[model samples]
Target: MADFGEILRSIGEFGLFQKVILFALCFPNAILPFQFASVFFIQSDPERHCNTDWILRADPDLSTGEQLNLTLPREEDGSFSRCRMFVPVDWNISDIREHRLNETTGCRDRWVYTNSLYEATIVTDFDLVCDQANLLEVAQTVLMAGILIGCLLFGPFAESFGRKRAAQVPVVVMVIFTATTGLCPNFYLYLASQFMVGIGYGGYRLNGVILATEWIGVSRRALGACGTQLFGAVGQIILASMIYFVRDWRLAQLLTAAPLAVVVVYIWFVPESARWLLDRGRTEEAKQLITKVAAINKRPVSDSLLEKIVVKETEKKGGIIILIQSSVLRKYFFTIILAWFSLNITYYCLSFNVGNFGLNIFLTQAMFGLTELPAHILCIWLLEALGRQVSIMSTLLIGGLLCLLILAVPQGNAAAVTALATSGRFFANWAGSICNVYVQELFPTSVRQTASGLGSIASRAGGLLAPLLNMLAMYHSSIPTIVFGSLTLISGALCILLPETRRRELPDSTDEAEANR
Candidate 1:
């Protein structure tokens, strides 16, 4: 058997062929932010009040101000009550003004939104306010649940099938269901579509990174992984721009799904993992791919060199059981799970609640998206310099501490809060991008997808919990921050146990991965 790394070197690693495939695989990452972070804009709470128009029946010429003043109750701050209106009365305007209606009731007809930042959103479209407001959170949770399910189903599927197939199927699913999400007639249908979209999202995310990483040399593996994330950051910026201009949620969603159609067509041209083919004893297929890659990269390969490619007969088929059965693998598996879970919770908590920072939503979101660009750039350097373990530990620790620091900032200091949150997001984004590369390096080829998938399940679980945790603000404003901060700190501390994988050969089997430390 020959070393695959040496074979990759001969074929011009990180050359034209690898660059094209990596770029093609990474393109979909740009769209994933539309799926993951669009919720913040699409579910935004617009300014609204009960339809006081019923009072118009009694006095048709009354001005907008007069109608609100007469028919709607005001909170202590003197804003018109969003969910309550006075009972309609038959009395004339003068009598009604003389003896104000004391009885209050929920909006009987519908809501009238005013000064809305968005032309429309799911909250407005579905009337998901007051009693139904919780449904908005449910929609996000449902999407995360779909992602979790996708990770579970696709992880093992990718392990059994091939990375190319796993990658292709999800793009189609995501495109279809994401468009369906826009066309959904009701909230239930919307939830269903979102769930399906999430499944596809999770599948494509896992496979695309693995496919790209498997194709690149170890020297450029960080580049390959972080490059995809850089595109993801660009996606976030694009999403912010899309939402700012196209405020209609349905139109924005349809537009978001449109680009993936291009991805679906182009992705089929990308090759399967040659490493995977050889590991599965498909030597002839691997040779053809290697030859093709060499030709594309303008490198020559000898038939003798190709003939040296062979599968190790000692390699065993792997599954989730392999992870559990081996103590070293088990330790890595659980630590990564916890780390992923914490990262997702902290990242999404800050991301989804971009509105609460008391700044312009569009600018704030754009700034948050911009923060990731430098964070990923820094992460590429950090992965190379500090090694994976220290990079992850330091980023998470610093990010978490920054989030906690917000608790000490005086309330109403929007600039201070925003500054702290953005800084934390910067580091959180750094840790997240590196973890994508780290997880792939930690496991062997046989169970890498499975391990990545299981880890994603934990991430989706954190995503699911993030919104629910944000709801904790209703009880105490500090609760969500404290919880998010504490989890991030704990996860950072746990990174102490992970082995540094810098400049290491990609492991091919369980024994190889165990021997990595």
Candidate 2:
């Protein structure tokens, strides 16, 4: 009997219908940044200080410049501080002049934004500054925490329910939550909305890729799966442009969510996976979809050909426990999770570090998104050249080592260090995309989405840690770089133990997965 991929080949692997659906699905891939990484702009503290209205009232005749100088405290670098101000003292000009040396305190009454970039954001609207600064951090933590649960929740659903149904449910919830997030009246509600978005993160990460992978043949599977990541990059560029035009986080967010809500209807247009249908014993539905595919590919298929389609064993195990008990698949499971966790951690750390790159945040952000294409292209080539396990290991090790290179450079060379850092980001981005393809190949159809969901949950654990690393400046500025770099290095080395799935067909069951051993 022909293997599943061979049956696909007989009909034509990648046809017009497959190409169109892949492009359609790429929209959700683009929406990823708006939820995950857009926090860079939304929660930006910006240059700010205590509202200076009281100072103006105290000295009615004083100029705007003089009032600012009197009320706001300047840091040692001569830039006005964002979080500090002087006491509302009734001091005279001599005492006020000496106020530069006076003791400082956190902002009182309310803070004012000194930044011209964003007119307003979730940060400024709710005063997420000074004592309240952790609101944004907490919001992110809640979101990651949601993702951690979402993966476990959604992974099993993809297996028990059909792929098309699993993919649809989270997106509808994502649309509602994301749209409402813009309208959230308080930071707590905003965090609540973020957690909802995180649920969709795991769902989309698992089912979306599997939906694409299960359809395409083995020869194009890596390209098919890794290629969606380029849309994620495209979304980043689109988001950067949206921020530039709108300059208001809520409005920009609404704009992003609105488009997604409109596109939810398109999800119905995509077909359920034929392979998944066959596995479920819905052979008639599978035959019809296969006939549709063959018709699109201009291949002739006889009724006998449809009847001859075979599954060696239709009965299968459920849940993640099957993976845990099986020694052969277990090695791939644990190592891939570590690599994904490190990838997510470092990618965001570099991405959020855009302000330090000496380039405008928009330009740096666009460049970061632009890197996704060539990086994915390089990953696809590497999958072909070095094979899957080697490619995964090489990208992970190279990315990790590059991150460590940042420590060797002197702090004075900001531009050079930024270049080195972006290079590290490039490799980490490549590694993360490749892992998406690699992990899907490591499991069988019965448990593919479940395994992928578990992987996403593990990776998002990195997402949870990434925000805390941003706060590392309070302890030591270099600590984040050192920590993130070390993680990737360790994850890369762990790749040595993962079996390669390069140019290999999707295993149909647990027994077939072990046969790769």
Candidate with the greatest lDDT versus the true structure:
1
* Clash pairs, model 2 backbone: none
Local distance difference test scores for all models: 0.88, 0.80
Q: Write the per-residue lDDT of candidate 1 for residues 11-76, one digit (tens) a residue.
A: 887999899898899889988989864478854566889987777778899998998999999999
Give the local distance difference test score of model 1.
Answer: 0.88
Q: Per-candidate RMSD vs. true structure? A: 2.0, 3.2
Task: List residue ranges in candidate 2 displaced over 4 A.
Answer: 42-45, 52-62, 65-106, 310-313
Candidate 1 stretches greater than 4 Å from native:
42-45, 55-59, 74-79, 88-102
Q: What lDDT tens digits, residue by residue, belong to model 2 across residues 434-481?
A: 888988888888878777888888888887888788778679878999
